[model samples]
Target: MEAEIITIGDELLIGQTVDTNSAYLGQKLGSIGISVSRKTAIRDNESAILQAIAESQSRCNILIITGGLGPTKDDITKKTLCKYFNCGMRRDLTVIDHLEKIFAERGRQLLETNLVQADLPETCITLQNNVGTAPGMWFDQNNKILISLPGVPVEVYHLIEESILPKLQETLQLPIVEHRTLVTLQKAESLLSKDLEEFENTLPKSLSLAYLPNFNMVKLRLSQKANVASDLIIDEYFDKLIATIHDDVFCLGDKDPATHLSEHLIREGITFTTAESCTGGFIANRLMQTPGISSVFPGSIVCYSNDVKISELGVDPNIIETYGAVSEPCALAMANGVREKFNTQLSIATTGIAGPDGGTKEKPVGLVYIAVSTESQSICKKFRLFGNREQIIQRSSNAAIWMAKQVLTIPL
Candidate 1:
């Protein structure tokens, strides 16, 4: 079924609050074979909400509205929806009781505004909100399903999973949707697209490929919407894509490169650590995000300064003085030193000039050197990236992770 999401808030337009609800809703709806045709963010005004609802009803079968459902003056979504449906407000006793219990549990007084939150459109069915005071509304108008939800992320998540999805399944005949994502690095998006041109051309109408690129990595997602042989067909295409670029593929799923590396380190009982310079513990931070990584990854050294690089990671003072801190030799030494210091089987090191300043003609900004080391051998690569300081640091960290994966797969 076709769907559209309307995220209502002035904060989203002003960039004070990001509209993450649409992404979450789109993904959830897509998983149930519902395609999100369009997503729109509008100000928290009655006219805007009415216009958005009118436009969405013309285009889609399912319309989802999020935000502006709070117990305050600017909270107009519930009233707007009532006006659109030409219905008067009705105070739901059950919701009032729910609110009272919530307030009592929290040891807070229920104000008049909090009680007014229980009021709903007379024509719509109220969807219970277990996590919050605001209740979701479901309106079936002329066969088009309109669902209005609260703006809070956690509450929205629970409502969708616990109530909305189940209701959708009960009402609609949803096709089985299957998606396979392959994470890859070292290739630009244009180049990867050219390489996969033939594979994409051969894909059936039911199957679609989307390239989601971030930093230096690309996520190749293959989706299929059908009931019969969907998984088998998707897997067949997935294997073909992997075979075409097996070396670049990090893992055959949505998880990041750090996650796969951590899993491998844990499975093979290999220890790891990082010696970070310009990346400023970014490499270590990404690895630490993976759960239980502490078992294999003991710790890391973030030597941002020359003194710390010399003292903590034991890089030679002469190496920094001669070839400079951002050079390949310094990266290699840092990698080797960290591997030895942590007493680990593997280690990653990054050093670079991620800057808007402090760059020479010889060593420009985004000049990064990444090194991966084992007890027997050390490998370092030079990268001349282009971006702001944060972007350069992020790309450098991704490069380090990719290099670590490559080093672990190869024998010393």
Candidate 2:
């Protein structure tokens, strides 16, 4: 089954808000053999919403809409849906009771607008929202399933997880769709593809290979529908492909780098820290984003200047004088110092000239030194990258993280 996602809000068009709902819905729908054909974002205008619904209803079996379902004046999706279905509004007693209980629990006075949330389209089934007050609506109109969910990401997640997904699974006959992804780092896309030319050629006609590149990693995704192909055949091909390119693979799966690193660190039971210079805590931020990282991660020292490096991270003044702050010595020193200071099992460091300016012939812009230190040994690498200041910082941060992963994950 194919579907269309419509995200309604003026904020999304003006860049004030990002339409993350579309991605979430698309992924969820796709997992149930419902692929997203197109995504449209529009202003919260009645005529536009009607037009969008009319245009989309005939094209796909399932249609998802997020946003503009609130108690405020700007929220008009409920009314719009009623008009499109040529129905009237009816207040749901269950929803009103839920709202009253919620208000009382919070010790807040309920407004008329809050009660208005219980008013849904007359002919649709209501999907209760456990996370928020706004309930979701599921309309089986004219042979198509149209689901209208709340704009808030958390509420949307709850409605889908607790209500909509199971309902869809029970009601619709869905095919088995599988996607297998693995990540490889350090190698450029061109080099990696050339190396995997034979493996790609050997892939079965039922399995399609897609290359998704990010900051410093290439993700290889293999997709196949079960009806068109056998699972055993897909597995055989996937194993062969992984075995062929296992030399370049870091972590197998579609997890973010931070998540992959966290799993490894947790499994290895190694404590880690970082000392950042040009990236200014970008690597640290990424690491901290993982839950339960505090057990493995100590902290980060962001020394953007030679003085801070000397004062905080204990970088040798002579090393800076002899080889400059963006040198391998400085990078190694920072890693070693942070490791010793935190008494960690591992540490990563980055020292780079992320510059639109302040570069010499000896050291041009985008010159970076990365170091990953363990209790017993340390490894350092120098890199010459290209991009603007933000990109340089991002690339440097990603490289530093990968270096840490490579060092800490050595065969035992």
Candidate 3:
């Protein structure tokens, strides 16, 4: 089945709020064998909303409308929906009770405007919103399904997962669509594709591969929609793809580098820390984003200056004077020092000149040194990366994390 998304909001058009709901819906709907044909972002105007709904109804079987469902007068989605369906509004007692309970639990007053949120279009079925006040509306007309959900991302996500998906499955017969993604690092997308050229040629017509690249990482997603033989075909091809480029593969699913590193560290009971210079603690911040990382990551030291490196991370001042702060020696010293100071089993360090300025013939910009230290061994690598300041910093951070992971995980 094909679908179209209509995201209604003034904030989205003015760049005050990004239209992330469309992307989320498109991905989720695609996973259930529904393709998103188009996404339209419009202002919270009644005429525009009606026009978009009417235009989209002619194009697809499913229409997802999000936004303008709130307590304020500006939120006119329910009333506009009623006009479109030629029906009146009715107060749903169950929704009102749910809103009252939510307001009471939070010790907030239930104003008249808030209570009006329970009034939905009479012709549509109400989809319960466990996380928010505005419930979702599901309308089936002319053999098409139209679902209106609140603009709040969390509420939209909840309704989609709990109500919308199951309802769609129950109402329509969907094909089996599955995906297997491999996230690889330190390899450019073009090079990875060249390596997989023969493998791609051998794939069946039912399967397709897509490469998604960001910074220094690439995600290879294999999607298939077929019968019982699809699973075996995907499994066999996935194994072959991994075997073809095993050295570059960091993870088997669509997980970021930080998440993969954190899970590995926690599962192996490895305590970790970092000493960052040019990357400015980006690696540490990424790892910390993963929940339960506290058990494995003690802390990180952002030794951006020579003095901080010497005083906090205990990087030897002599090494900095002899080889400069962006040298391999300094990077290795920082890693070992942080490991000793924080009492961690593993440590990562980065030192680089990520800039549009600060380049010399001897030492240029984008020159980075990354080091990973363990109780048994210490390794350092120097790289002449190329990019703008932000991109250079991001690449350096990814390299440091990949280095640490490689040191910690030696593939048998």
Give per-model CA RMSD: 2.1, 2.1, 1.8
Off by over 4 Å in 2: 228-232, 410-412
| Full-model lDDT for every candidate | 0.90, 0.87, 0.90
lDDT of 2 by residue, 1-412 (tens): 8889999999999999887888888888877778899999989999999999999987888898999999999999999999999999999999988999999999999999799999999999999987789999999966799999999999999998899889988988887888888888777988888988998887777678888987777898887777644453667777876887887787787876767786678667788888988889988888788778888887879889899999888888999999999899999999999999999998989988899998889999999999999988999999998899998988887787678766665331
What overall lDDT, based on C-alpha atoms, would model 1 receive against the true structure? Answer: 0.90
Question: Per-residue alpha-carbon lDDT of model 3 for 71-127, expressed as tens digits?
Answer: 888888889999899999999999999999999999999999898999999999999
Worst 10 residues of 1 by lDDT: 403-412
Between prediction 1 and prediction 2, the one with superior lDDT is 1
- lDDT-sorted candidate list, best first: 3, 1, 2
The residue-by-residue lDDT of candidate 1 on 1-412, one tens digit each, is 8999999999999999887888899899998899899999999999989999999899888999999999999999988998899999999999999999999999999999899889999999999999999999999979999999999999999999999999999999889889999898778999999989998999989889999999999999999888765344888888888888777788878888877777788778889999998999988888888777878898999999999999988899999999999999999999999999989999999999999898999999999999999987899999998899999998998888888866677211
The per-residue C-alpha lDDT of model 1 at residue 158 equals: 92
TM-score of each: 0.95, 0.94, 0.95
Where is model 3 more than 4 Å wrong at Cα? 227-232, 410-412
**Residue-level error in angstroms, candidate 1, position 396:** 0.7
Q: Any idea how many clashes model 2 has?
A: 0
